[model samples]
Target: MSSAPVVVVATFTAKPESVDTVRDACKTAIEAVHQEPGCDLYALHEADGTFVFVEQWADQDALKVHGTAPAVGALFGAIGDHLAAPPDIKFLQRVVAGDPAKGQLRA
Candidate 1:
């Protein structure tokens, strides 16, 4: 674990027909994830009709655990075929936030 927070940006594009289902599914999943331990923030956003997850964790290790959780794994597995394309996910570290700060990302 580190002092800086871990951020995750994930995007999921839905097939036109699966948009509604995808939205509903992600909403349910995101809400559940919000209650997870070490989760600082787990929010969903819509980006050009794609579902975007903007998340913050207490640290990298926490994020790793959450990523592999049964809940998360199931959601992804269940929705894989419904997605318009493969999910786009990126792990990030804050550079300048909350009044001026800088940090680095580590694997």
Candidate 2:
């Protein structure tokens, strides 16, 4: 696989009553993801009732592996019904510009 780093943003909207449940599941998965090979960043954020995950990986191969990791499976199983809809996942490509450090995600 290519060695280019991968960036992903996944958004999940929780049902009003299932907010805590979804958050808990995501936190559990984040802990496991942090220990995975090639994981650079796996952070969670929330606003209103929407949860967002911003992730960075070493390369395409690593990202592919992460997609099928046990943590991912557990995360889905735990929060599947709690989500308002299917996750909104986006894979991104960086465009280099001035101030390289400020322009792109570290790691």
Give the whole-model CA lDDT for all candidates, comma-separated: 0.80, 0.95
The candidate maximizing lDDT is 2
Candidate 1 runs further than 4 Å off: 101-107
Candidate 1 lDDT tens digits, 41-67: 888898665999888888778887898
| Residues 1-107, model 2: lDDT tens digits | 88988999999999999999999999999989998899999999999989999999999999999999999999999999999999999999999999987999998
State the weakest 10-residue window (summed lDDT) of model 2.
Answer: 98-107
User: What RMSD value applies to candidate 1?
Assistant: 4.0
RMSD in angstroms, all models? 4.0, 0.7
Q: Which candidate number maximizes TM-score?
A: 2
What local lDDT score does residue 106 receive in model 2, on the 0 to 100 scale?
90
